[model samples]
Target: MTRGYIEGLLSSFPKLMIEGQQHTTVETDAVRYVYQPLFEDMYAVLITTKNSNIVQDMDTLQLVANAIPEICQFGSQDDIVENALQLLSVFDEIVSLGHRENIDMAKLKAIIAMDSHEEKIQDIIEKNKEKEAKLELKRKAKMFEMQRKNAAKAGITGAFPSTGGIGSMGDAFGSKNSSNFAEPEQSTYNNEYSPKPTTSAPATRGMQLGRKTKGAEMLTSLNDQVVHVSTDEHISVVVNRDGGLENMEIKGDLSLIISEDDKNATSIRIACLQDDSIQYKTHPNIDKNQFNESGILTLKNQTRTFPLNQPVGVLKWRFVGQSEDSIPLSINCWPSATGDGSCEVNIEYELNSVHMTLQNVIISIPVESGAQPVVGDIDGSYDFNRSTNTLDWQISVIDRNHKTGSMDFVINTENLNSFFPVSVGFDSSTSYCQVQVLEAISENQSVEFSSSSKITPDQYYVI
Candidate 1:
């Protein structure tokens, strides 16, 4: 129909309807207008041809009237105008091509809700992926910053050293190997340089004869490209009340820490200064025959590879010294009680090794609770902590110049055994067992590598 005809028909609705009627119908020669009164002068209406089924039209109009209240609140003119598009959509679902559709209210409401469970799950997964990506970026940034700081502290300015194999001892002595692991020839130089003393004094701790080594620089520079060689020594020394060695035991191990990204399967050649007093043991997976004959550490199976990103203990050596002459540093403590409830303690440490230097030496002596030590003639600094009742003697560096030093302190205790069992801790750039890495052979070729050796007193005390 034209717009003017539809408007004229809508305008004629009031004149044709009775005042008390609940439903209204207007008939003309060609068509009929059927409508129901809504709230506040609004109506739900439908137009159809006069020849159409009046009963079905009336049913469709009743459905449309029922749906208008569900779609628009209050059924006011403003509410109907606000939900005009929604009402039209509902009307389309009710009637199709001028015919009523076979649909109920529950099915129509379900179609209008339009909810999907899978879409919500996909959105959550996408958000989580974005969060994980941000966390990974932060972790990498922190790692890079730490590496930069370590490189600067070690005075490493340029790029890392070339990953070329060592050619000669003289050429690659101090430049390539930043950690001062002795050369193969110099492995026995410690015994020749400083002989073991015959007196009841400590022997040489290790063979650190040169300047301090910067082993951290090599490890930091090579990062994941190089394997790490470490020697950890656990020493336990017990001295009697008369400053005599009661028992001494030393245990050490050589461990290899490989990186996950390093795929070069290598066999390490080593130069060991064999001592009759020490016993050696190899790992079960190692080739014992090859290690005994040529001092090469390799896997027993030729086809098997070393486990990546883990520390593997390849060799272990043990030494049991019953003499005080083998001790690196000797401590003598003498306590004299006064008539009062206090005593004066005299403690002295002598470094017997003339060739090696010890760093960060700390001697811990227990004192009575709430008692302050009056220190005198101390060679180094001392800190008295009353909470733990510990007097810590800190010696920064002990070399030839400051080898022999003494510390005297007075405390309120006549029991000398309270100050007994003084523990000592130190670090040296040397290993008790002078085993040096000669080279690392991979695929019948020498692979570039670095080595670090250190000696530390795990449990050295005098009781």
Candidate 2:
């Protein structure tokens, strides 16, 4: 029953044309397909989430259209139109019979929306036809005398009367498609409408072919990765992928850990899969050529990383963005050979230790599966190494000793050299520190040592 309904739905949708490429598809359940009519002989498709089965069939058509926009090169425009009409017809049949029980108010709304969108598409297509007619008229006025000669060359089969104008052979075959010898010269810029702008802008030239577009809806393409985050206040994004990780697959729940010292001082640690990459692309509903600050950052949203073997990297736990009550973060990912690697980062901040003004600083830590540490208490001597300016807290630890686990340290950097001699602090100027976890597991459940860290430096350091 579901299959039949799907088939019916697909049978009703129109075939979308972009350039010469065509898409006649029903898409799938829980999916949205957009056909934008661009300039003459041009169109585009925006396919959003879909059920697995539908994705396979629809993706094939999408890949072809994306690779080459000239759909008519392989077949006639009539063939493309017929394909679309057949699909839409099937949809009409299904809706009429009511085979699917889930068809309710939402589905009906979508159908109405689809109808409205198609109407707009048809309007664009008509506009393009009118523009094509004007260009054809100009072509007809060019060589009035050569009409009979070209008519004779084209033969009289289906060749309507030329009316004694340039409308002889050129009208039958497109001016661009004119026989190599008889074709007239073309200028660098013809009046032909440049197809509708990509998801980056609005239609500046009124030419419309037959494609799906988005005015404000989410429009996108395959293989495009991005991160969308809304913290109930400010929205932030990071949209670049190059010498960086690309495949960003969110397996489970992830979050941001923030610590605040009163209302003024705040520290943040974003504990997520670090080395993921996403293709931040422009929203399909928008145009590519329009001047929009929105589009400028559309392609690059957020950057987060985590290394597989090392467990962490430079920016694993750093300040992403600040808020009144919380901090926001985002990341993108694409497929990579390194097993979707990322870097884990941790940031520690201690304030006013000299005066000890701020007491009871609240610390927040977001733990991941297979990565939580067993907290252990240490009983040993605390000694300050003035020679190396370091503080050493020695403790006795053993495997299966009922005391193997992780520990958190709160220390000040300024007084390090005063008691010991190292550079460590709780201020913004302090460099990042490493947190090491030592565990003892038997050969049956062996002990392993792993570590992760976060750091801060001038942006120039990367260069």
**Which candidate number has the best lDDT?**
1
Give each model's whole-structure lDDT. Answer: 0.65, 0.27
Q: Candidate 2, after superposition: displacement of residue 323 in Å?
A: 13
Provide the lowest-lDDT 10-residue window in model 1.
181-190
Estimate, for each residue in 248-353, the C-alpha lDDT of model 1 and write its tens digit.
8778888765543344357888887687888888887778999999999887776656643334578888988867877778888888898698889988999876
Question: After aligning candidate 1 to the native by TM-score, how far in Å is the CA of 336 from where it should be?
Answer: 2.0
The C-alpha stretches of model 2 lying farther than 4 A from their native spots are 1-107, 110-114, 122-126, 143-463
State the TM-score for model 2: 0.18
Best model per TM-score:
1
The positional error of residue 56 in candidate 1, measured at the CA in angstroms, is 99
Model 1 alpha-carbon miss at residue 407, Å:
1.2
Residues 1-463 of candidate 2 have per-residue lDDT tens digits of 4789667545545442233333333354565564433224443344435543332222222222322322233334665575665444434532344222222222233343443333433334333344445666566555533665677778853444545444554665556444532322321221221223224322344444685553212112100211111111111212222222211121111111111112111111222222223212223322333213322211111121211111011111222322211211111111212222322222222121121121111122212112222223323333432221223333332112322222333332211111111111111211111112222122223322222222211110000
